[model samples]
Target chain A: MESFFTDSPLDHETLRRSVEDDAAGAVLVFDGTVRNHSEGHTGIVALEYEVKLPMADKLVARILEEVRTEIPVLKIAVGHRMGRVSLREPTVIIAVSAAHRDEAYRASRKIIDRIKHEAPIWKREIFADGTSEWSLGCTACK
Target chain B: MPKLVRVEIRYYAQLREDLRLSNEEIELELPATEEDILNRLAQLHPKQAALFLASRAAVEDEYLPRGTVVQDLRAVDVIPPVSGG
Candidate 1:
């Protein structure tokens, strides 16, 4: 899929191959993982993501379309895991392919940034201390 | 009972936690706008007025302008500042 939100673990091979083509010379993938720490929260256990489907799904598609038009990338695919995502596991993955490394790299970065800023998805960090807090909220979308 | 329009309100993130509610259905006077719905919610939840007032309302697929009329709307999402990557 070009963009989506899934409750299950993301499939990497399929995401990569979704943009695989002979016309492309470079394909870059970005895997955003749930880490052990976030700012003041340490020993994080997992990250819980909440998204309103159909709306979120639609917004993601709009983002991809906007990115595609702005960048020279030939193809783009994005996947984000919803609900509880354990540490070290990929929470989001973005793959972009272009005729050159520069375009691919630029598109990959731009897409993720906009997704983070625009998509109506929420993340709460679960700490080892038995407390959780939503990260500094998205100012742009709010 | 007075004329009314019921709008389902779905809360998210900080606002949901603060309100201790996932969603609720609210009844407003017949001529209600997205802005009026929010004001009523804030009045009903004075303690969390800031969050309620600051929330953005979305109907079926898109976020509605605060001043847009809400009579034809069936559901509205009260979105707080998001934290997604």
Candidate 2:
């Protein structure tokens, strides 16, 4: 099934190719990766990602559409990896093309921030000590 | 006679792990708000009450505004604040 969420590795090349446009002068790619440690944690082994199915896909599409409205992006593509993502592996990838460098850069940044903040996706940080805890991406939920 | 609405509640992340549940179908009386679903879940699993109460509610594909009366609801996703990037 074609979806923003994938259990396998995200195909960055394919996504980049999707946003290739003749009129666009710049194509920017950004990937948010899993690191060894998160806030207040160390020796992180991996991150387990879970998404609200069907709905998660809708949220992703909606976010991208909204970006198009807010930014003058010529073309854009995004993918988020599900299941367990290892350290240094990208959790999400975003590619955008625009007529100039500034629009491409801005759209790329906003897409990453908004998707992380609004998408109905969650992650658990697994420590090397064999412990795991949910990453509290936002505190305003309380 | 009150018509009971059968709503499927789907859990994610910590709530799923805490309750050991992925989804459950439950019946509720009419005139129920989306918030009531969370309250009912808390009543069923008191141990995770706080998390359930704090979660955002989404029915079907869209987010149901807090305290909005659930109309034609079929499934609800109790989602924690997102962390994905």
Candidate 3:
């Protein structure tokens, strides 16, 4: 799938091969994982992701389209995991295939950045201290 | 005719917890803006007024611009700032 949201664990190898094509010479992948700390806070236990459903799905497709229009890439795929994700587990994966490494890299970065900024998904960081906080979207923290 | 309408309101994240709801149906009059809805919600849930007013709203599938009329709104989602990866 070029874009999707799931509750199951993300498989990096599967995502990389999703964009595999004979016409492409290079494939780039970006994996986002749950970290153990954030903003100087420690003991972070897990992350809970929630998506707005059809809207988030539509947004992902729109982002991919926008990126493809701007870059000459052979294929691209992006996926995000919802529900509870454990520490150090991959929460998102983006893969892009192009004739060259530079375009693949650029497309990979753009897809993830746009998904983070445009997708209507929310994440709550659950701490080991039994507290949780919602991450501020890209715009608000700035 | 009295300009009356009903719009579904969806809450997310902190706003959901603060309001203790995930979604609700609200009755409002015509010419009501998103701000009006937030204000009314704040009136009903005073403890979460600040959070309510701080949220952004979307009508149908598009973000409702400030001062946009809510006359034809079938649903409006009260979205707190999104945090996704």
CA deviation > 4 Å runs, candidate 1: A140-142, B1-4, B29-36, B66-71
Q: For residues B1-85, what per-residue lDDT tens digits would candidate 3 score against the true structure?
A: 4477877778888788877799988887667777888888888789988877777787666667898775666778887767788
TM-score of 1: 0.85
Tens-place lDDT digits, model 1, residues A19-133:
9989999988889898897655578899999887888889889988887888888889999999999988999999998999999988888877777776788898888877888
Candidate 3 is graded, for docking, as: medium
Which residue pairs does candidate 2 place in steric collision? none
What share of the reference contacts survives in each candidate? 0.74, 1.00, 0.74
lDDT of model 3 at position B49:
86
| DockQ values, each candidate | 0.62, 0.80, 0.66
Comparing 2 and 3 by lDDT, which wins? 3
- Alpha carbon lDDT of residue B15, candidate 1? 84
Write out the backbone clash pairs for model 1.
none
TM-score of chain B of 1: 0.83
The root-mean-square deviation over C-alpha atoms between each candidate and the true structure, in angstroms, is: 3.1, 2.7, 2.4
Clashes of 1: 0
lDDT of 1 at A140: 35
Interface C-alpha root-mean-square deviation of candidate 3: 1.4
Q: What are the lDDT figures for the candidates, one per model?
A: 0.82, 0.82, 0.84
